[model samples]
Target: MTSEVSRRDFLKASAAGAGFVLTFRIAGGATSAAEAAGAWEPNTVFTIDPSGIITVHITKAEMGQGVGTALAQIVAEELEADWRDIRIDYPTSDPKYGLMLTGGSWSVNWTFDALSRAGAGARHLLIEAAAKHMNEPASECIAEGNRVRHLPSGKFLTYGDIVSKGLITATLSDEELKKIQLKKPAEYKVIGKWIQRLDVPEKTNGRAKFGIDRFLPGMVYAKVIYPPTRTGSKVVSVDDSEARKVKGYISTVREGDIVAVVAENYLAAVAAQGKMRVTWDKGPHANVTTDSITQDYWNKAKNDTSAPSWVDVGDADGALAKSMKTHEAAFWTDYVGHAPLEPMNCVARYQDGTFDFFSGSQFQTRAMGDLSKLFGVKPEQIRVHQQYLGGGFGRRLEPDVMLEAGLIAKAVGKPVKLIRSREDDIARDFYRSCTLQVLKGGIDSSGAVIAWKNTLVCAYPGERYGGLDKQGRDQFSLNGSDHYYDIPNQFVRAIRAETGMEVGYVRAVAPNYTFFAVETFVD
Candidate 1:
């Protein structure tokens, strides 16, 4: 995972060979002679073939967010490539693609400039190639509709003709890439305009490949009997005699806390799963309930003074004591689940110390690394293929299902497609943290609020999911509490309480709850 190639390393390794194929060096480089040959396929991101087709490798997962379309628009706007000729595909798990994550509403915001620069750089190279063919300056040529046109004489050359004729050979350096001029917002032909979504056609035609739709050549179907609780739950025993009576039942896999029933097909797998009897130790969380969580968070919000202060300004205690009026309020929100349209599913194949996975993952790069450690193999030994997500809603960000599929595939010695039923998905999901907020405010004689204090108590999403900020705090649980008001004295803090329940980033994360409390108090 630490072997990620830097920008300089990528530029140095990339070479434009004859026949118009651009070879990009990834983690292990080219493994075969065909790849090493001048076939000219770009490694992971965007690439132009000799035929002038612009293939864009989208790193973000398309979870009904139009990310694929928005990203393509950004690239096409600067690349000046024909929209009709543009195609979109997902990249494999490789560090060369950068942080292959697609949540927190960051896909377009993070990639806007980088993708634009990449397009502009590619356009610059194409124009440079056309300049040599026309014997004109690169500045005098304009790229339009996949063709470079000399403005003086109106002579044009297609990108394919120039590239195939060996006119484009130079690749941009990191400095040159930085220096490339990007188009202003007013000049964006694709970004601001309404273009049809790339995924719409496939979805309309029923040809889209969701995680559940994944099928491998020798793949079997698997279904698990999950414990009541995610943590501190262990399988005590399993009786599969009844499952063995099923016609298509293949085998039962028991690894750690996971108990899976494998069959020749999905129906048989579900049927066999229904017949299997399993016993489990419910552990400490067996007694935990929703009401108990509510009471625990409320208590922490009122009394937890040891909580870290996320924001503080002046002395709120002195200001509130001297104020003529004071207001106090508390707000709470129950835990919720990201009930995406499609249930969790992953297809995995393990063989010869290598693993291949197919699923809709928001964090494929992280998944590859985690799976490598879980399987005790190198990062390169795992290949994660992306698929269209029916809906992520921040749920697909975790790769628990992918790991389960890999483990089952390894146990059965065959490709296995593990699918979670609706009930299983809902019951086992990493839920949004139930929150409790306490706010205290002070107002002067003029009714101008001079001081504010807020305390939040909730499960730490980062602690549960391992994405803590540099301050060693789960910012996800404290967002939106910091107000923009001109209060002279303000204090904001969060108490990380253990609810004995799993928590993760839902669509808006902590902002949803924090903003609700702040806005309600202001009104």
Candidate 2:
């Protein structure tokens, strides 16, 4: 939505708390902005200024998902604010935001209720203030089109007019916010209707800035020469004498098995990295191949009996055993990479005691925490200037790529832009683990599925990220196996396969493979 409000106006409104500054609590029980100044929650914080410009600061990562638009609509629908007056802003990562992550399609679903209340709360205050100004009963006043309308009097006050008069001062408590009546589904005016996506204009006009588009003055370029194995190995030696011959070549920074070749520009860095000679002690995993991983999954699925069932219903074992009509099938899926068009890139700067990361990250909170732990600094010392991502598909969730840029920047003592070549990006990607699913289905005489059994084997995606539950089960490895069918008996279990390599979540996570096995077996 287009707005005449300038950036100066937004800043002044935020500073003065001009109109209603609505704040909702985010995850991890973080307090609202009104409760504590700096202890801000990662919620939809929208400000209605004196000019009637509504600025909604969306904290979720907007990686090709219209989450920004959807969430804004949720606010506008309840606030009765005009769509054209809305403006969206992506805020940077901070402890106040509390676990800024964008994945699993959780952005809108988790925030809908909270944001609706915030908007409704602000609207309630606006109506009260408008009733006082118009000398009308608050019950008869309704908020619509960014203004308060008195039904009988046929008079209205624009949100800007009421805000400019400094009339809305009452705060909405958690209890009061809950008591406010929200709009019904049929009464929704902004949500569910197709409005122009907030990010479409900037994206279509090439004005959207991705992680790779970020640049700073005097920032050098870096290209990483990864260890021979994807899991990483120790560096044996480095002979960059030949790389010195390349034009614009700067130097090399080494951390463990990884080496970053720095140069004046990306082209120079790539050329120099190609010329440089570095030997790696590719550990035991050097011999780990796709075939080996697949075989490991097969072995685990066939023999691992101690593996616990992630989803168990009724008596699947008895049904499959007693049933005469049974079908069994095996499905295998190879490792798939999240090869987003933008590849992996980040601009990092470590100056004084602060570490700045200008990157499009899906998990900004994790990235900031990772860099803080890696550099031995407090979380407050790190700043993540979140940018738009070309695509995520679960790749940007990992902080390894961003960590490399930070490590390189700190080594050189200058702002460094690390860009990965397409080849390098694919080669070093944390691929979706190769998975094997052996499914068995038992059908009745009437051809209805009576029993279902599935044994999935794959390297746990969460194993590398410390996401495993107490029983040592990674949900990503077993998702989608628990079918939604009305089958009376179903048993789904997972056997962990040690691929000795890091695996990650891709587009649909485990469902991509799990559903294939389950549906195919039923067929």
Candidate 3:
């Protein structure tokens, strides 16, 4: 359903809730007073410069999920404009507007307000800009296409013409951010319609540029010698003297974490890399033999009393002891990957004033912050260009991949294009956190649950509530909501233990794991 929140009209919108490469922005937390008044944190930079062309900055990077197009449709609808004659651009990856991250399925959800606000605000300003040309009050004007109309006279002034006179330069206040009117669902035109994706043409016509295709004049080549395994490994030593003797081989470099090649050309880079040899300090997981992350999850699930408790309804112990039968189940899940076909790679350059970076990240703000922290530069100097992800099944947040490119660029003092091997991708993803749900439910002969006891252990990393971390967003809460099937007694206790690997959010998060355990227990 739609609201006065035209996807384009700017909304000081914030999601109090939780997309396509299949994600939505994680939209919930304690609601603040500004939020209660419908103010969302502004993340987009919408401006139509001195020229007539609209240069709206999109916050979400395209990952073949249609976010770029979907987000624009909302804005155009509010601009009451046609896509055939519009220009949209993504934010430079930096914190000025925000880094363009295409993760968390938040492309659409996150922009609800910002887009709505951007659209309504833009159109409002455009109308105001138009009204100023006509010496008419903005209230007397309504916009149609690029023209703002005076209802009484039925005459109109074109936005382009108004711009020819002068573009509006007003800024938004806290009150304006909250005060803008939004479009209701009944009136939505461009959004929620079967709008075609904009990236399709570039992809079809071969005009599209991916990270691997990023190149400029005098760009040399590189090849990374990946560690043997994913979790913990290191480069023990390297002998590159032989490579140095080869033609086209320039020089080699090594730092704290990585060691690799630098050459004059692509084939030279390849030949040089092939000639070099390296010894690695492999990790324990080097012997990783099975799809079974099952054991690790279960062992960690045992019992951690300090685990956050999300649900408790009745006296679970007493009910279970008093019940006729108890049903117990421990669900074991397999570790999964964000296995997008594109794998992982990044393009980086350290110039005089800025560290220019290009990669796929789910959190642009976080990525920029991470790089700034690493380089000891002001966040403003670093520019992150959020690009289309070939496919990001949640694998984009590994920041290590982006970091590798950044590190190499900083080390060499030249722009570097970094691409991870497929094996590099598979072996090194912040994989989906598989879990073991140890559940105990008591039931009477009447098929009524007398008590429910569920102990949960986080297999993945978690989200922050009020900037504080909690067990993977509690899934048991959904079941505990009503015990859904009228379970008279229930106690859902969760135990969270730290996984050795860095675990973070994956699709469906807690609800999927919790529901699998919950629905099975009910059945």
Top candidate by lDDT: 1
Expressed as tens digits, the lDDT of each residue in 227-279 for candidate 2 is 77876488899999989888999998887666879999889998999988888
Task: Tell me the lDDT of model 2 at 261.
Answer: 90
Write one digit per residue (lDDT tens) for candidate 1, span 182-227: 8888887888898999989999999998888988898999999888
For each candidate in turn, the TM-score is 0.91, 0.88, 0.82
The per-residue C-alpha lDDT of model 2 at residue 254 equals 89
Better of 2 and 3 by TM-score: 2
Prediction 1 global C-alpha lDDT: 0.80
lDDT, candidates in the order shown:
0.80, 0.79, 0.63
Q: Scored by Cα lDDT, where does model 2 land? A: 0.79
**Runs with alpha carbons beyond 4 Å of true place in candidate 2:** 1-44, 133-136, 151-155, 312-318, 444-449, 464-466, 486-489
